[model samples]
Target chain A: MSMVSLTVNSRPLRADVEPRTNLADFLRDSHDLTGTHLGCEHGVCGACTVIVDGEPVRSCITYAVACENAQVTTIEGLNDDEVAGELRAAFTREHGLQCGYCTPGMIVSARDVVLRMPDASEHEIRVAMSGNLCRCTGYVGIVRAIRSVIVERKARGAAPRADLRTALGPVGSGHAGAFAGGADKTADAPPARIASPVSRAATPRETAKLDADFVPQTSFPQSFVVAHPVDVVWDFFGRVDEVAACLPGASLVGTPTPEHVEGQIRVKVGPMVAEFQGVADISRDDARHAGRISGSGRDTRSNSATRGLIGYTLTPVEDGRATRVDVSIGYTLTGMLAQFGRSGLVQDIAGRLVSAFVQNLEARLGQGEGAPAAPVVTELNAGSLVYSVIVSRLKELWRKIAG
Target chain B: MKPVRFDYERPVEIGAALALMQDEGRVVKIIAGGQSLGPMLNMRLVQPELLVDITAIPALKRIEDTGSDLIVGACVTHADFEDRRVPDVTAGALAGVARGIAYRAVRNRGTVGGSLTHADPSADWISILSAVGARVILRSASGVREVAVEDYMLGALAADLNPGELLEAVRIPKCSASARWGYFKSCRKTGEFAHAIGAVLVDPDRGVFRAVMGATETRPILVIDRAALFGASGFSTGAAEEVAQAAGMGDLLDRRTHAVALRRAFEQADAA
Candidate 1:
């Protein structure tokens, strides 16, 4: 058994819950905050929608322990909300409900729709509230009711957001809390909030983000470019320290040996940054003006391992007036940064870093890093042009970089 | 419906979560969004003895932009994508896909990682991501492997997820600004699970053209080559027929319905 504390409907509550206790069961079976109905139990039915951290999420699947210290606002809390009060009236006036089984879910969803789409059209309203299903009323009445309220609110210039609750006075007080047009609101209620999962049926973490002996790493290809002439660039590349200085939010510091270059590079993935120290075996072929740099290292901070193989070719362009530097880097990232591999974000950032490094290189090359020529805002609807620009940019930046 | 008894742990880090999964005897299921598993628990379709909740692990929620792709953690919720919380590198097609999944509440809770990991063929991300040639990351105590969406999904409600391995994230390659994308789904009604899901992604310059037809049955039919998806007729009835025949989808769906959906997808991508 574990203890959990949360602010539910402006009420601070504490309870001992089972390890398997879900928020829906905790609320309904314990404190009896049954206003947040549950239809499908899965997330499909909007019946379990409740405001958690000001965002409406399905409570049916939310673990009770996960809500520790969270602020939970259920339908029961909307009694004092003026917008909800007004909407309840509109729902009744429009005959928006028939069986009333789906009323709470509808109202909760309607609240979110109004807050998000203040000037929503009829079609938009239908789409926004489509998650909540009502077998009765065919949803036409519900749609009409929500729309009328939106229109009425617009006329009054009343903000769609729920403001500080003003009292509705007594329109006939009831045994239940929800102001769903004088209904017992808790008829289908099964969830009652208990102090914890310590009741007769009651039964239910570490600080690490991952718990693997060795998290898997993904290896992918990434690229970058340089504007300097090939011979000049290759000469510049020979100077490891200068090249390392080019990367923004990154720096590689070390001495170069005849056979290899050893350096430590510090890079910030997000708030968590790591410094990778390694030795690279450099293979340079001046005859072909091509080279391969391979290295292996470990992040001093996270102890994550990293390996990279970068192959480059220097091609003369514009009749040797310019040098085209093409790079193909296949890197394997493991441990702390492996998760970032799935989204392909780390690689994208790697692309951005190269761009930043290129500008930095321009500065190092005695060429002032001018604000890159005004971006060519290719007009929309030109797919062919877009493709060309992207292709050119890849040649200019890195292969398969930005769109 | 309340879930039966089960042990639960909310691991703050991935290492701890993986270690917990390695324990023997108890059946373990990874619960990130709980949007898919929760309902199944209530309906008693699945009742695992233990649930490893990874939502609170901050690292799992991070979004990083790879040069060629925009990779988001598996825990990113649908609303995050819909609201552009992360860098939308899919030319608004990714956001559009997130927006039309279930509804606002589900979007707030249902995660993209979970959607793909669960591998519901009728689900939006499965068909759409597959159409766009996205990749999924699978990690376990053993190691990590990246599987293209096309190869990852085996059939309806089935994914190539190994036991004790969790889906890490999905890598959606950056689409060109003008790359046309069209995704169309036919449902019995609003909010209903899709019946016929068609997606078209075309970037003529890169020679990337893909067409996918989903929700017929066990697996979604796909056409990734440029010629197969965009024949001489350009996704017309005849083109769709050829694609359907090539993809073995003609027997799965009404040829007319398949043709109509294919045409809509092609036209939308062209128009957009």
Candidate 2:
């Protein structure tokens, strides 16, 4: 726990809170200020909007410990405010709310819109209030209420509060002293609990969605040439264990047969990491030097699941001295991670993954016959891949700049 | 969603923050505005052992206008830019871009260095700063180094940061009076992460006409060739397509959307 001192609704309050306790939870749980709603704990939903140091902020994402010595005004604090009074009257007259769940946050955000952009147009008001979502009224009534407040306040000669831009950095920042370290005693604390594994019963749809011959939502092709012959590469692919070892962040959960294997692949993209655990069905054809692997996996932490199909063929290249491997991957991802989908980002990460796999595969193949496979990588460090890719990309960019 | 329990430290000095980063055994992350890291932490996307809050660092909170360049501290908020708390060295270009980032509520806390270091490909600062010819000042306990904005972000969520180093400030070359800048981003909704971003800065006095095609899932495609889009005729879509194609964008529709964005930004610049 950390000690945080702040003035809440004109009252000087100090509390000891966990570093992870966001301001909304700090207010609701500790101070019993339940007016700030939490719709999406991520910053996407503005239901937890509150006033901190005279600027609106998302309390759900902003930790209370970070707001030391700052002033916080929840919806309850704004009861005596002039703008809130007008907005309250307008909202009631316009039927701006029905369920009243988003009222507190809506009022807070709407007050800012009125203060900042007093002369804003209707379209501008909609754009300004886009962060705050009101499920009821289709936002027509909410827009009307805000617009009415702006017009009425303008007629009353209330100038916009252009003076609120006082702080230099983030709101509620710069009010605290240097680090005294965490106030919580660490010697007697217990070990943190391990996260519980995701239950399969929770997501039957993920398993049901994985079927043979099912078309993938998105597919991309990648080809790489290695300094090995086709027959040698083909033999390596046949050994599912060796192949799995070649792929970074992939490890077998159990002993695998020629036709079936169970594995987990941990994929990291930027800050997000997902470890997908599932089984795969593998098939190969000797004549065509081609094979296919289909599987589905789910990451328990993010509750994101993916169904993927990988098809590859090995062809002799460079006068049979080397091998050219052509790979086509199709996948459909769903759930929380997929909701922030950037297929281009996935492709970029996949390209790096394949490059890493090929490098590992080359190293394994050069080990000669009956050699033990290289140590399996438990996690794919995308940061290292990004670094390697950047070095070359930088040279090209500099060259372009020179020209 | 809530973040995993972690120790927090609010360092008041840059040296102290840099020292905290030297603890190699612990995964320590430097947090400025918490606008970008906040959401990630709430979702447990990044679970660091210790969070070194650099917001209270006095040096990083200061912004300086050096006649020819604007030295903006890493902790200066987007609202600081949007509200002109920091001087507009780019002839309102920086303010215009700052206003469109996330929203007013978020802008109140999101910082320039935070957004750049976070290095989301779709983020506005990377594209605009790169176009306006900005360089970031990186500091570590060892020493300090300067890197061009184009070289700052290696890939998505990847900044070219050495261990124990923190971005101190961004040194943006003040645009000449004759400079014309335009930036446009396409999003499904207002204030969302952009799908396609196009920013162009043509400063004949400064001998710089740069075009950037951002939100490409990696380092943005920087078109340095002036004739690729900014010809004697001002702006051309044919050149935008050629530049996009040369960047190896194979998707026809994707290339077209980016080209259109570039063209729109170009037109916006041309008008300015």
Candidate 3:
């Protein structure tokens, strides 16, 4: 626990709070101020809006420890406030609420809108209150209530509080003293409940079902050229162990057979990291110089699972002196990581991951047989993450295991 | 959702924050307004061992008007710009853009530097700041370096930050009397991540006619050759098609939205 001193609802309070405890949790759980609501713990849903240093902020995302020496006010604190009082009456008259779960935050945000833009039109009021989402009333009653309050307040000769905040930094920041010696209070605090790391080999593999007719959620194409001839590159593709070594962040559980292979691949994209471990099936057609590898894996940490199918064909270029590899990857991702992985960003990360894999493959091919494999790069190149590395490794491992 | 347990340190000095970042073998993240990083942290997408809060640093909160430019501290909130709490050098360009970021509550705590350093392609600052030719000043234990906002973001969620380096301030050049700026973003709902963003700054006095096609899933595509971009009339749809193609936008709808956004921005600038 860390010692944090702040004023809550005009009352000076000091508490020993864990750094992970957000402002809403500290208010509701620690101080019995349960007026603040949490709809989505992220900043997207503004249900946790509360007054911090006279400015409203998302309490769910703002850590309590960061609000040291700051003034915070919850919905319960606004009982006697003028604007809130008027809003309460208007909301009741306009039927602005249905369930009232989002009322606390809605009122907090609505109060800010009233003070900041008193003369805001109906459209402007809607735009200003867009952050706070209400499932009921379709926002018809809510917008009406706010507009009525604004119209009445403007008629009362009230002016906009545009300059309510005069400080520079974030609303609740710049008021606290620096914690000496990093987190000194955390040292004396009891050990936190942390999730234990999942061991790779020991954990039972809840392998996803893979089949020939499996369809993918999304797919993209990627290609790269190697300086070596098609036959040489094709021969290199036959060695599954060697091929696995060429790809970054891929490792096998045991020796692979022609029909099935099992392994794991760790993919990192920016701050997110996922290690997927599972099994796959390999198939090849020599006449077409093409092959397909289909597999599925799960990242136990995020509880995200991915099933992918990669098909590759080697075609001769530069009169057989060089080889071009055409790869098509299709994948289905479902879970927490998928929720965060925007589609465009996934494609970008996959594109970069493919280029990095090609570089590693070329380097490995440059070093002839019996020579030590190129240095193992456990991390993807250029800070990339997602399906490409995982798919590419599946293709490479399938080739070696099947050969 | 609650974030993973992590140690917190509120450092009042940039040097102290940098020192915390320099701690080898520790996953350290710098938290300013905790607007962008907060969501990621709550979702467990980013789990750091220690969070170094840089908002209390007085130096990072200092804003100065250099007559020709506004050197805004990294911790300056978007609301600060929206309310003109700090001097604005871009006329109302900064304030206009600030008013549209997220919402009033988000602007209350979202820092300008935090948005830039987070480097979300859909964010407003990267598009408008790059169009305005703003330069970001980065500070580290080694020294300070200034990089153009256009070149600051390497990719999505990736800023060109060396280890221990933090963006200290943004140097936004003042708009001349003849300067005209326009920015348009396409979001299904107000304050949501924009699907397409178009920003243009045409300043004859500054000899800058820069247009940007932003929210491209990577770096924003910048076009400095106004002749090739604009025809004798104004923004040309033909040129927009080429720009969209060059940016590798394959979806026809996506390309059309970006083109229309640019066209609207051009119209807005013309009206200005």
Candidate 4:
């Protein structure tokens, strides 16, 4: 019903499209760009891969309306690029594909890997291509094809590939930072200064060296500081029943105590109920002017080892009108629980647990009689900022490395 | 594979887009990146009466990063995030999940606000934004209202956004130097819908931590609390199960295949 003009693979074309018309559909249906296929119509399969403005994405899941004035490239567009040619040759020479159903996506995804990761390893190649599924080739040939390109490129004295290792550094690493100039103005700012000088350098070689020197072997402490007076906060945190009651799905399985208490707690997650028996260790730090509490327990029903520790430090600020609390925790997992673990899933569940605990603590502290009325300031330190930047960068680098 | 016969409108501004939506009502569906919605239409899954294309709206395409937060327009695509042209928080989060969203071409056309509004539990934005405590700004003829990511998603493909309301932008709180954040997803293959997604943001100094899990259900499951509890013995089975149960996340096996993933996330946060 409407006329729209857009560019595809550097060519401007006009089309009459419905509002619901997807760009991928337009290309395949109207423009005859069949190189981009459709699989998992819900946006999971990489069969419909394309390059728009130098980044690769799933064309199948993208709408034509969203790309009114954007540049787009299908597999057809790669006909002229040397990197694409090399990848094609490598795939053929290495037998990188089998059915070829996923070839277009494989090649497009590999193109990104090669461009971003000039110095990738075999392991890195596998990780990068992990996103694109090839049911037939068993990934052996695909990995070899990509690795061959990197090896050949390196042999020619080309720049090192942007492997996941280098991408894991701080925001300003040599390779990752190269693209920093292209980042939006907001993301271009320098990272906050942390107390420690943790190097944010890119490159697996550099990361390996840094890890060797500072592995962060020391576990997170079980004590922390709250922004309120130690005695006042202690009176609230010391009660086991109150702590259990404050938790969303926590139910005390035993008695309360002043110094230490042991209890069993049941948490219902979906259809399963996981229970843990834990003991709290409470103490005071006079030198640093803080209070601490540590709890350790395991899921007896699931027969999994799950441990937790909490520490708090309270600092009076603004003429005692408000208090600042520094809390730290260290947890561990072992036994049956260790087998099913992956990076992202663990982070999500852990993040939710922590958030719930904080909200509960805040609500409790806010409700108590005669509680101080002050803004609770949550500050991120320099060390943490550096870690976030490095972790984020590394994740990107990993994708390129895997591809 | 092309879309069925339907009307199309490309409004130069938001007002024109809104007027078209008002006239067409339920018959119209707005398109941004078309990353998710595009494929559905191609497959004939959704047939709308009218198509109100907003890609030409210049204001909706800008990504603004204020010191305290990052404001992403509705038309910002996944390609934009992959290009590192957005804030680190936005780019990093998108990059982590981009590889799994199909292929390079889809990313180029996918928009952040579009994904969030679509409210697909398996979609990347649902979990990432919820985990990061991002807010969605909804615009309607009546006015505008801001809803937290955690509250906006009511269920799978179900959101609090009304039919006439448009998702204008997403606001992500600026991360601090000391905050520790991580995002993870589990799927059968790369560029696949997540069987489970976990996102964590921890501020150790302030004793605050937020953990969100999406794709396990219709909406993202959020938990906000003190980070220290993760280190306690109670964290693994006690607090973990409690938090999971409260959020109606179901059983470990049903929601996520592995128990180790749950434990690892807890351990990582405890260490942070």
Candidate 5:
């Protein structure tokens, strides 16, 4: 056994824990903090919700020794907060409880939601509370209770007592009392009113501001500058063999056309190998007066389909020494990919593919000879001039060596 | 259900932690947040003879933002990333994924380095750190060595961390201003282990993108590109099918689910 010191809900606790003791077990079994329940012994269930340093997490899945010197908060600690009280009241008034097994976890989770999202909507609240499951099928009422608090708080310009009571119901209301039963019994004390208003539920504006703090922004315009004539760059880009060489783990097959290009692309990524037939539309961007490519294809291996549009604009820079290239791509998912919508995983894969393409192009261009040391300008170029020069030189050398 | 008996140590410093690890050798396990390892212990998946608790090592808890990179100690919990005091690039992604880690209690007890060391394929940090091109700092009796995040992850529940070595901190380069990044995961539920995860960063100005996909396998699948060929039909078809084949989705228990995940990954990559 080892002795470790830590703070739990503002109280200092010193306990002798075994090396294998989990933090959730220590809290529930040793300290008797039953407010933190165990749903999945694994990390899945949000049932064992507890605030560790202000963030909520599963207690059942945490090891006790890992929390040495940490500040921990269970459902017991939230009793003193006005927002928790309001959520409790709203839960009761809205009949957010049934058999009540999941209530403690729900309350702890709800406390986090209220603190983070005072003005959360019914849908946002539902999404935020999705981690906590209620077998009693009381999610509708639970959502209403949470949303009611938000509506009430927003109307009053502060934490409103009426909203809290209306959303949760008055203290001692049947449903509210039942959910509070375990907490009250564990504390062995009567519920007391909190005098501070500063601790009121976070309003919608506050939650929105908070949401804005973390939401990723998409602000960059997709554009690049290449130093070659538009015709030369376009010719190289139009060649399937040359394009294939510039793509990692890719091989191109078949012929090209003005409206569409058809071929087989064998691409290997990590442990997976995909062999698929692809077709794309090549067109002229009339508005931006650039080259526009758009089309859709399918992966025969997974039977997944992909669709996208790419716009490219080329401009002369420093004579014919360099050309600025701009590329923009808009892609959509269908078939199997649609299942992963809104999960955030799709965004990650898209980013990787784009990055790899860029790196491959850079490497391929770096290998070309007499690629201008300085930037160049060319009105007729399709790609970067320096890159085109290198490619052209390499082709010439290959031809001379073969001859 | 109580935990089985085992030896424990509270190391006051990094040297003490390393010394204890050296003495105990493989018999000892180092604990940080205890989020992932704790459940393993409770399940008896790992029964170490001695546990060296490095929480008392103050040096392992610091987050230093140097001009070029951000250095984070091993003992730094996900909550530490939520502190406004931390840098925006590090904090934003950390908080975003950390918030999805089970719930509040787990995040409280979980440490940043611990999750990476555990190398759970479904873990958020694995994919995120891998995509960002972070570096892991390891300390042993011999000295300290650094490994790139991509090189550190060996496989499922496997890492390049050697014996008698303890992870001290992680360093991540500051993202370029033109970088547009995104992270996505598919799980049975919001807080559950991810079925698949992808992390991506795109530099539109530089015409480059970097991506790492995790959970479909033990280590992350890395890809880099400049030509934006993925947006082309042929490349998209080839890449999507390739991902499916690489993941062995057809033989998977839930082939449909896996296929969906792979397709989504491809679409997401194109979108990014």
Candidate 6:
């Protein structure tokens, strides 16, 4: 049980209620504010809607303990509120309600729509009403009622109230960034950053966006110097069978086709290691001496996703046997790979990978006669790539922190 | 049905809330908006011994506008966001998504932190914010940590939040001029959960292009900048199905539904 105090319907109310008691039950059982009804008792039906600190909230879903030291308004409070009173009259005049089960929530929601969305369109009204399901009435009359309220409010030249509670004072203000004492491990750090609202333009496209499940596709460019002639290096990478072998943490599964190779690439970052089955569609343009390997795969166990568009162009150097290989890689990675795919970390790892591959290539090409020696660098494994890079990044960040 | 008997605590500050949740050594659940938890409570899906109400904590409700990132408090309601009372760097995309959550009543109480912490893969915040590269600030007894929104959800109703860790705020980057986005959600009708969700965000300047599919009832699957580099016309009907099958959706119906949703999303992005 919890001792709770809150201002309800312009009166101070105190109660010893169960911690899980919802605001709707608290209002109805203790204060007899049955006007704030309950329907589904979950969140779907808005029958138990009430204004907590001027915002319409589903009392059925809101806990009574959470409302301590706050202002609450039930349907009974509408008798005194000018905007709600006007809305009640409009609802009655337009037959906006049916069996009245959803009326309380509808009316509370209507007050919010009228007060906050002063210039709501018909579509906006429908959207606002969508959250509060009214099974009895088809919502045609409800829309009409809210629309009338909008028009009336607009004609009167009324601005929306900036504060949640018109009767009570505001609830809280900003605080010091740090906690009261140096009690926990976080005490050594600076205080939390302060949050103050910043004005934004009406156009949405120009502002900040927060979206879900939007894994962005990104491309990175890598350039490395190879210690061999452009033609020699180009020919070396031109062969499909040899080119696929250079990939880190890779093993070809079957006989290679002219344009296809099936393999698995393992990503091991310390304790986290994931193996993804990948199929690369190998292609090369003889005229341009450029290669493009477009491939995608997923690790079923980790539920991680990987897609890569790797294209390389070998340009001749001004002098000597050195050739500059420009690698432009575009990839979309989700789940595990994405977890470590920070830009700085990725770039550093990629640079090291190219360095390792080029060193291996230089070793194999050093053989003047017979087949090239098996140029295997054990640390070049993808697991080591992900692990070493992540560890180094963490160490670098830790260094900056210590500094 | 009412929830089983539980103790409750409402702390006015973040530190107090953290200490209570951590040091109390009892089964505690943090309730921000209560919109989602309320439904689960009635169905008896979960009942903790203590409910730590973080709504009154002033810090969690603050909206700080840094020059580049918009720091939104965890308790900022969808209604507050929908009404444009907070800073949105994603243009009006945040408000637009907020206005459509469940209902005006639900939005009024449902919060960004609660939504993200709840971690529904099909949730607009999970897909949209993750696509836009938002990070969630988590406060715990140890300290504060920031996690990319895209990497937060592990599976349905699963998140990376550790015990004693509470989601504090969300940091979103301001939309740049080159950013173009499209989101398509197919719900049975209004207010119902989505059947299939496709969200794409393209920013040529930052080299970010992603197409994400949600509402699969698990984790979201994404296709990177290829969607933007290739353009919408690049996807034939066969290509869309291939991309869906590649993501490894569990069932045939899901593959088809996700494919149609992704195509619609690409078409919308192209039109935009």
lDDT of 3 by residue, B18-83 (tens): 999998866789889999889888877777878899888999999888888889999999999998
TM-score for chain B of all predictions: 0.94, 0.96, 0.97, 0.88, 0.86, 0.92
**Each candidate's DockQ score against the native complex?**
0.10, 0.58, 0.49, 0.09, 0.09, 0.13
lDDT of 2 by residue, B173-265 (tens): 888899898899999999998888899888888898788998777787888777656568767776676666665565787788888898888
Residue-wise lDDT of candidate 1 within B51-130, one digit each (tens)?
77777676677777868887778888877777778677767888888888887776776788888877665688888888
Off by over 4 Å in 1: A159-403, B250-252
Model 1 Cα displacement at B245 (Å)?
3.8
Give one digit per residue, the lDDT tens place, for model 5 in B170-220: 997776666656676787666677776767666565454666656754456
Candidates in order, TM-scores: namely 0.63, 0.93, 0.93, 0.58, 0.58, 0.63
Where in model 6 is the C-alpha error above 4 Å? A152-403, B23-25, B227-232, B235-237, B267-272
Model 4, A248-295: lDDT tens digits are: 456554466655666655543211234555666567656665555566
TM-score of 2: 0.93
The per-prediction CA RMSD against the true structure, in angstroms, equals 20.5, 3.3, 5.7, 20.2, 20.9, 16.8
Q: What is candidate 2's lDDT per residue for A269-372, written digit by digit as tens?
A: 65567778888888999999999989888877767778889999989999999999999999888877786557887787787788778778878888888996
> Model 5, range A1-403, lDDT digits (tens) per residue?
5565667889987776554566667787778887777776655556777765555666665555555666778788888877778888998899999977778778877876766676677777877788788878659999888888778778878742332211110011111000000111124332232212223212111110111122222211354455555555655565545555555445443456656565544443211233434566677654444776665555543344556566677766778566666666565545432432222333333333444454555555555633422212211111232233334433543343233
lDDT values, one for every candidate: 0.66, 0.83, 0.83, 0.59, 0.58, 0.69
**What is the RMSD of candidate 2?**
3.3
Per candidate, the number of residue pairs that clash is 48, 0, 1, 99, 69, 30
The local lDDT score (0 to 100) that residue A53 gets in candidate 2 is 93
lDDT of 6 by residue, B1-272 (tens): 67655556667788888887775555567777777777766544444556667776777887788888899889887777776777556746677777777777777677889888886656778877876778999988788999888666644555777767889999988787777777778887687778788777777887877777777665566656473225455865455455555443435776778777877777876676
In candidate 4, position A8 carries an lDDT of 78
True contacts kept of 4: 0.19
Better-scoring candidate (lDDT), 4 or 6 = 6
